[model samples]
Target: MLPNPTLDQLQVFLAVAESGSFSAASRALNRAQSVISYTIANLEAQLEVPLFERSGSRQPKLTEAGTAMLEDARRIVSDLEVMRARVKGLKEGLEAEVAVAISVMVPTDVMVDVLSEFRERFPSVSMRLNVGELGEMIDLVASGISTIGIGGAIVKQDDSLSIERIGHSFMMPVAAPHHPLARLNRPLTLADVREEVQLVVTDSSGHTKGRDFNVLSYKTWRVSDIATKHHLIRGGLGWGGLPASLIYEDLQTGRLVALELEAYEQGEYPIYAIRKISNPPGPAAAWMLEAFRASLSRCPNLEAFKAQLPFNRSKDAIAAE
Candidate 1:
């Protein structure tokens, strides 16, 4: 049977590669230099490949084979460390996997920032994320499909679920530059918007079925996803409200124009984190909720809209539990 190189061998190899010298690697690993050398020798013997080339007065240089294998060795060592940490977390009652369902309306940058932090904080915990529109986020959590959900407020209260308001998103009425509303040359009235095709985002979960929150136009096209709605609106196919955070750059660049409506105006939608009361979130899940809230609070677009609102009113609105 072929000899197998152990993790210790790979670790020693990586340490040497990173530190650039056996002596430096030994100091970094708090091991004897001879032991490090012996382990590398054994590893090379097992693989029948020279890992490092040694000269009488020079630092050990990695052989071609060693350079090729260096990244694989690092990945193997990293995976092992992750496995160990995951085992330890499981032993401490931290969930091995957490499913998160977030709203499509949530700023993508904020989601990326929060998930990046979550990965750093809980490297061992696996995450399954679902991005959906409106109440679908809540439905996923309520059905136990997700450990937690972050989305717009749930109008239909379910006794089995607990919800906490985490933040607020401003939904601004906007349209593409060439859209009729943008070229009206006068403040837009409801009658003007009523004649245009209003692009609206609907929920797949039917939570908002048979209801209209801010339907200004009589003619409407409903889609289930926010990205599609944004695309359609950007194409000048219609006009609709979109999260301010998502369209800040589009607005700034004049790709989309905020409508100066006569009566209907931009509205603030409360963002919430929901979890089943029956299956309360574990430590990792709880941490994710707070991380999302922190990320949303730091969003510049949301912050700008928040600044226009009464500070105390915003606080009071977000304190909804």
Candidate 2:
């Protein structure tokens, strides 16, 4: 192991290197000018090196070796300060920090509620939240780029990850209340749905891999964002499937209406709390996951949503694979 220099010695070295004058360093350190000179001299003596030279000036200048050592000394000083700060934070129960990635389809209100509850329970933990789609969130969590992922569950299985199904939501066909189909007295058949232009929301890459609801195989028009999709649907431009939780008020107020599709597939993608299998979450991350689970429990829409996503195999069994 390498010998470690005292904090006092490193401080004096940094002061002299930064101020470039022993007298200036003495003033900065609130010590006598002789003390700064003696500290540097003793440090050089112990290390057996010439750290500075007079170079025809009253104040010394760093030698080549001293310039090189200064960089390393600066880094070491920074690391020590960071370590001290982290220790102080931990002792005060303020060390918690987490970065979270969430899906945009989840309501802003839901996020606010989760954050409110989480802050109340763990006021020390500072969270950084990023909202995007499922694929972006998956990439972030899988790469250890994010501490926890919140959003729609992965439809496919990956051996490198473990997904915990913390909650579920239902997808239902919706259209603007005044749309022609909403006035139809009969149940909507496949042929009827195929005739109407459908509005779909996808990512920037224009990929609609797993999100296509099987109910409508109509002429699909794709938009790149959820907000745009909502606007398009509200404007009566097309029909689309939206989360029931998000559109409940719209449905009740007659701004949007749920379309009844005949012979439609009722499917539910698991809403997961996904984390990489190789990187188990730390305390802050784990607490956030638990908080999400708690949110699901108290949410009134969850019970009906779980019924929609009936699982043949338990989440524990799926995670085991």
Name the candidate that leads on lDDT.
Answer: 1
| Clash number for candidate 1 | 0
Model 1 agreement with the true structure over 1-321: per-residue lDDT tens digits: 586889999999999999999999999999999999999999999989999999674799999999998999999999999999999999998999999998866787889888888899999999998887777887798788898999855877888888888877778888887777877645788889888999888777888888886888989998878899999999999999888878877876667777767566555577888988889888899998988888777655544664543212222322331
Question: What TM-score should be assigned to candidate 1?
Answer: 0.88
Task: List candidate 1 segments past 4 Å from native.
Answer: 1-3, 23-34, 298-303, 306-321
Question: Model 2: runs farther than 4 Å from truth?
Answer: 1-96, 105-109, 203-211, 298-321
Question: Any idea what lDDT model 2 has?
Answer: 0.72
RMSD score of candidate 2 (Å): 14.2
Error of 1 at 316 (Å): 44
